[model samples]
Target chain A: MQALSFEQAPPPSVPIRFFLTAPLFMLLAGLLLLIDGEAVMASRWTPAALALTHLMTAGFMLQVMLGALFQLMPVAAGANLWRPSVLALPVHLLSAIGAVLLVAAFHHQIAWAYQLAVVAIGCSVLAFVPAGMLALSRPPGTSHSLIALRIALLAFFATVLAGATMALARAGLIDTGWLRFSSSHVALGLAGWGCVLVAAVGYLVVPMFQLTPAYPRWFARSFAPLMVLAIGLGMVVLHPTAWLPLIGLVALFASVTLDRQQRRRRAKLDATFRFWRFAMGCVLFACAGSVLMIFNIGGNAVALAVGVLAILGGFVSVISGMLYKIVPFILWLYLQPRVQGVPPMTRMLNEQWVLWHLRAHVAMIGAALLATLWWPAVYLVGSLMVVSAALLGGQLLRVVGRARAALRLAQPS
Target chain B: MTDRLPPIVVDARRLLPPEPMERTLEALDEMQPGQEVLLMIPRQPAPLFDMLHNNGYAYTVESQPDGVFHITIRQASGD
Candidate 1:
């Protein structure tokens, strides 16, 4: 029998490349969104403002999250999907086109783009459904991460459908939004789908990469219900009200509790831990901002603040820190097999890269939040965020390069 | 004399569970009247002599210079 060789497998398919490239797209999308925001308020550009939202959600978050889920699920669940390459090609193409058209349609007010985006995104979800169900249907002993992903994907589908319908309304295909359609989309997309996936991934990634023990069962068990309640209640209220506060309360309580649980992890604190803390801080701020917006205490600015807090502040911190581990590990997993005892994957990349990105991510987050208050310095913060995100993306790609170089050296003559 | 070695087949996953493997102990207890069993393991998880002392199965564990080991287990105890 031949020895195990990691490099024997051909390169990861297009879906993987698309995923690895997502952070970069997010930087560009975010830059555009911030510029558009500046233009919207200044009357320099007639902007829907919703384009900025989709640019972040569909452009940044959805692309990265979906790709990561496809790769990680097989490994964690031992599901060993029979045709990962086949699934990735079309999924990436469809989703990318969908996100682009959606952004164009809404931002430029092009009706055809909106219709095309709906068909593309809806088709992408349909392609994913069977693979997701097959992976989830397997017997017990699957990782808890996979279980969370299955549920989160359902929420993702719901969020997409709602958002597509709202887009149709924008195209005059439907009369909506006193109907609470936009609010429903935000709840499902941000709070229901994105929040749940983030929290669930935190459970596995934090422990696996950081060498921390499992999250306490209490927090893990509490997450699903709170996420569901937040989405369900938000739909009922459709605006900031007493019921909305209840949703915020549950979400805030959950974030605080999760932070406390993460703190108790005694692994001699690293920057990843700092990311976890930062995410919690953002979550708490988002809760306050959301509730305030619901009460009409701060006008519509509160929603923008909440959006920035959740996306740039919460998700960005978590993903950047996690990449500190994931990039190096992927490098080591594929390369270290050839080196055979030279250095571990963590040694290949150091904590400094994480700290570097952390500062940049945090700085940009500060600047973006500042933009909400000043509205003029949006790009200054956005520039900081975009540069930092781009730097982090480049570093991850470099690890892939390093892995490929090592494999070339080991191939038999 | 130089000789060719046949490729050995092993089931990797089956080896993981049911720890503290005892080849002689199992062979002596279950060998079909004078039948012998050949055991191949990377390393013995349980002591071979003690396994024989406790069960009195006929066996020999031949340690190879490389990692793997070979053991011959013949029925010698409980029938």
Candidate 2:
């Protein structure tokens, strides 16, 4: 039989640059909360609230997701991203600048800011989405993770188009018809892009990192396609009820993931695993709240509560957990060849800092939920969120610094 | 370092990326003539196959029904 061969992953710097920038956005989001606490709590559609939401979704979440994808495309999917380092420089810069401009546009209602944001973020997406799709176009080997990545990329493109349309409408460059597409935008971003990507990565990492058994073939194969179909239906129907199945599928994914984590062969539980389990629990809770709201049992209060749970509790928790594992692992891997005595992956970062971050993250999520229910708690939410972001960012930077120091030591004198 | 040593076994099923790849490479580097390395991993180490071929190594892979892959690599005939 012919030998099996695949492309190597991009140099560690490509992903690490994105990783290092993500927490700054989270920090910005936290500071935004502190600056506009009362205004942010008033209404979800308010300018301040919109800015805050995008800061988390586009700024924090998308950065980390892209970074992870860069690392995974070659290693897991056997697909080579075209000149990743060269491409990532512009993509990362534009994405960061665009997120800032877009949030600033919302906060200040500046037309120029919105226009510039459209150009910058539009360029970033144009660069990233197509490159990613092309890599997956004919991957060397077929796996559930690769398929899921493809589906998520398509969803990400659709989400970006919808968001750009909405931005144009807000800028008075388009008619109000685009405004009606808001719900579709949220569905595409959260369900289509965010949850599907997470599910895809979870399929690969949950088993590999946690020493758990492979996810059932049936579930791994079908989940993303079903989610894509549900998202398509929801977009066409243009009603909240259409999202019912999509949410149901996410909850099922979470349930199965938690079940698998429970069956992990490794008995020693770490903070990353805790973060994952907690995130799964949050997803379930979010879905339940979504169901209640869709059936008209609860009003805007319930909707806000659900958003908080999904965005903060579910997505942030999972991303933080992954960062804890992925960052240190990458550092350890990159340092292995250059350094004579490289440390274990676990030694790249201080476990105490990770555990501390986890505790603070939990507190931040709780405070966020409380703030959703009662506006008075926004201050607590803001403070805890700032601390959580700082803690997570500090840990990541420390690991990178350690890796650099090792590289320096290994250099020939 | 003896040529008659049993093939060194590297079980990488539970480990994540770079670990499996790293261990496999290390085993190949230390392999003596007529010695082999047996790798037990969850997925096909496709990238490694190319590296080995470029370096004039011979290998065979067996895919288990349960999705695990068993790969055996040895040095090509002569120096």
Candidate 3:
């Protein structure tokens, strides 16, 4: 076995900063929705709709996933990162700035914004992908999680490269046919990068936290590679039929996760558990919607609905739930040895507040689903999204604040 | 007669994260000199190994066929 070092685990600040900043992007998405709800709900191709989508995907999702990697790589996979705290600084700043600029570019159709966004986002990806790969080069063991994580990193690189090329094309900097590869870019980003990363981490956390049986070994081993292959095939075929297999694979993952969770030994169904259940259900719904779109059974509205279910309903919900557990656990671990009376991980954040956030989140998803059919409901969806984001951000601050207070008490005057 | 005591066995396979770490540290705290801790955990406790090493402990980790890790930790000589 490769020698492992817990001493290499970055300071909690590294991951915590990313986790805390993520919800602000969600808040920004909510604000954008409220301002341009009509245009956003009109069609997926609208500038406003594009901005809102990137705000969720590139802004919020990217932040949390990166942060989780900085933490999870060391603890779970024994992949020692070189000075994660130092690396996080540039990656976080550039990514957040790039995401904001990208949103601005989409919303205003600004050439300079698009160019700058590509440069900034490209740099951030460059900084991260190499460092991440180096760390994973020799993991302690060849667990399925590590293999999937490696594949996910490669997928992340491809996704960012495609996105950058597209951005430059949009900026009129390079006149190329890369613009026509939008579907491929989306496939690589959402399935190859997003879903695969989630599954990689899921292999460890699902069983560890939920006390469920380990994912079926065969499924765990094949899932990421198959996902990458399917995405590649879809990219090449450039046909809706090519996407069916990809969608089927996504649904399979969600169903298997839900099945495992069903047998969880935990007695208390906390907010995290409920959130995961809701997310899995949304994934199934999104897959059905995708099938409808593939068959041309529904119009542009169905496409929008699928995006809503997958991004907001599925990814956002699951990431938020993970943050609840990860943040508190990190804080508890940090403070335990230093402080005299560090609270249990469960008590770091108020459960009541989490439950309230869950309610808002569920309501927001419902409103968003309705908004697809009836435009007026977009206003309610925007409002509830704002509330949900604010609640999530507030709880994260509460967790940090509690940790700070405990640390201060331990300090010698 | 040898002064070394039988190693304390801590079956932390079922415990959640941090708990296993905490229990291992607690066991080390209570251990008399020359005693060892045989920690049985579901996965390799990578982080705990670093802590043990830093705090002047020596450990050997063996992985079982059934995916359990058997880690034997003791105070390093002259600590």
List TM-score per model, in order. 0.75, 0.89, 0.89
Candidate 3 lDDT tens digits, A273-345? 8898899999999999999999998898899999999998899989988999889888877786678756666
Model 2 is docked with a DockQ of: 0.31
Considering only N, C-alpha and C atoms within 3 Å, which residue pairs clash in candidate 2? none
Least well predicted 10-residue stretch by lDDT in candidate 2 chain B: B42-51
Candidate 2 TM-score to native: 0.89
Task: Give lDDT: candidate 1, residue A244.
Answer: 71
Query: Per-residue CA lDDT of candidate 1, range A1-413, in tens?
Result: 00112222223443346557677666766577556657533321244456656766787677778766665665454444447678777777888789888878977988888889999988988897667668766736534555566668788888888878877877778886533576677767776777778766766565444544456676666666667775677677545573474456446544654555464434466777788778778878887787777667876456667777877787777666666665555455444324533244544554677678788878877777777678877767667767776777777776666666666667755
**Per-residue lDDT for A15 in model 3?**
97
Clash pairs detected, candidate 3: none
Which lDDT values do the candidates have, in the order given? Answer: 0.63, 0.85, 0.87
**Residue A89 lDDT in candidate 1:** 76
On the 0 to 100 scale, the lDDT of residue A408 in model 2 is 86
Q: Write the per-residue lDDT of candidate 3 for residues B1-79, one digit (tens) a residue.
A: 8766888889877676667887787798888888889999777666676667667888888899876789998878934
How many pairs of residues in model 2 come into backbone collision?
Answer: 0
- Show model 1 residue runs off by greater than 4 Å: A1-15, A40-48, A80-82, A141-146, A177-179, A237-239, A242-246, A249-268, A338-343, B1-79
Query: Cα deviation of A71 in candidate 3 (Å)?
Result: 1.5
The residue ranges of model 2 lying beyond 4 angstroms of the native Cα positions read: A1-7, A140-142, B1-79
Worst window of 10 by summed lDDT in candidate 3 chain B: B42-51
Best model per DockQ: 2
